[model samples]
Target: MNTKGHCCPKYVILQAVYFKLRFTLSYRDVEEIMKIRGVIVDHATIQRWVYKFMPFIEAEMKNRKARVGKSWRMDETYIKVKGIWCYLYRAVDKSGNTVDFLLTRKRQRMSAQSFLIKAIINNYRPRVINIDKSGSNTAAIKVYNRRSFSKIKIRVLSHL
Candidate 1:
């Protein structure tokens, strides 16, 4: 909070954190912008704030008092990490809020299992999972004791 390079210490640091969250901007860019606004904080300080706050943000996102609804839409998106295509799995609850997410390179049994494990462990497990019609999903359902909708009401999903 000793950010006294002509910048109001708290405002500059708070703006840097807010900007980083709202937009995927680099720490240095955020630092420069704060400097332009008459605030002077190092990029490393911004990085530290983000690193410390990210977990709390994720936890708040995951542990809402409302469990949303039973219907869950699960999907995988492709993103480049280190120039490699990484599969990011995500889910939206019935209320259309993001529930959980996972990132992995392999779309195999282990990846699916880990995603499900996290979802189940951290929050309410969706009663219905609407994932793509893929072999991995098929195996995942089996591995996690999920069944077709006509089967188990607690862990039913699409017949893929």
Candidate 2:
């Protein structure tokens, strides 16, 4: 979305978000950076801008992303959110391009299935899925393929 009101230029907003995300900068750091660039913006405003524009930016990137190959890699890792551990399911194409990711509290079969479905919807169905030796992931792929109209191959790898 373009700047509609008496707001900062779109490039400035984009630059602020880019700095904040690309670097390990806090909102205040981003604000100072923007200030050095001659754009005066509050840290809270920067936070609001990130919260508002991140999804739009991601959607635009997804639309512009290159076509993924047939083979895909799927994996899950634990991430600490606030203080508790959460499961982060992520997928990537054979070329190492990011497909999609999902964060959930539980790492169950249903969660894996949901992550796979979301990845398929957002990106594309993979011809072959390589995953670690997780029974839940295997079961989820099995159930999803069974219910899905397309037949997808699942390869269990000892190490991903």
Candidate 3:
């Protein structure tokens, strides 16, 4: 982010970096884009800018991420990872934005409880959670509610 001694202005460097990251374009492609924009920046320079600025950009993005809604939909399912099956526990807000996810080797009450705890820690506790009729998930929520004395409503989707 510090552009004190650079020949190009901050905006030009930022544009090149943005193009590279946002479009997943190669360094040479970004250089050509800068050339089309009359910037004349080199591919190597663009690469350097990306290497230097990507971490800062990622940190800033995390800081600017929107807060998830209070209503969440939770689920767990099997997913293949490197040809190995795993349980993917996930939660999303009513707007469909991801609240949190965890992949575990086992599908059990402990795993479900861990995922719920992680989601609550990372985001705010949901007012209500809609979930399929999974016994482990139901038990996990019940335990969490009992321990925390929280009256979080659980709406079981029997049709799922």
Q: lDDT per residue, candidate 2, 10-49, as tens digits?
A: 8888888889878979999999998998999999999988
Question: What is the Cα-based lDDT of residue 139 in candidate 1?
Answer: 69
Model 3 clash tally, residue pairs? 0
Best by lDDT: 3
Against the reference, the lDDT scores of all candidates come to 0.71, 0.88, 0.91
Model 2 misplaced regions, further than 4 Å:
75-92, 95-107, 131-133, 155-160
lDDT for each residue of candidate 3 in 1-160, tens digit (9 for 90 to 100): 6988887999898888899999999999998988898888778989999999889888888788899999999999999999999999999999999999999999999999999999998777899999999988899899999999998899999765
RMSD of each: 5.7, 3.5, 4.4
State the lDDT of candidate 1 residue by residue for 37-148, as single tens digits. 8777799888987786667666765566566566777767789989999988877787887777899987777787778768766666666777776566556756677543
**Ten residues in a row with the worst lDDT in model 3?**
56-65
Spell out the clash pairs found in candidate 3. Answer: none
Off by over 4 Å in 1: 1-11, 57-67, 75-88, 95-97, 101-103, 130-133, 146-160
| Candidate 3 ranges with C-alpha deviation above 4 Å | 1-61
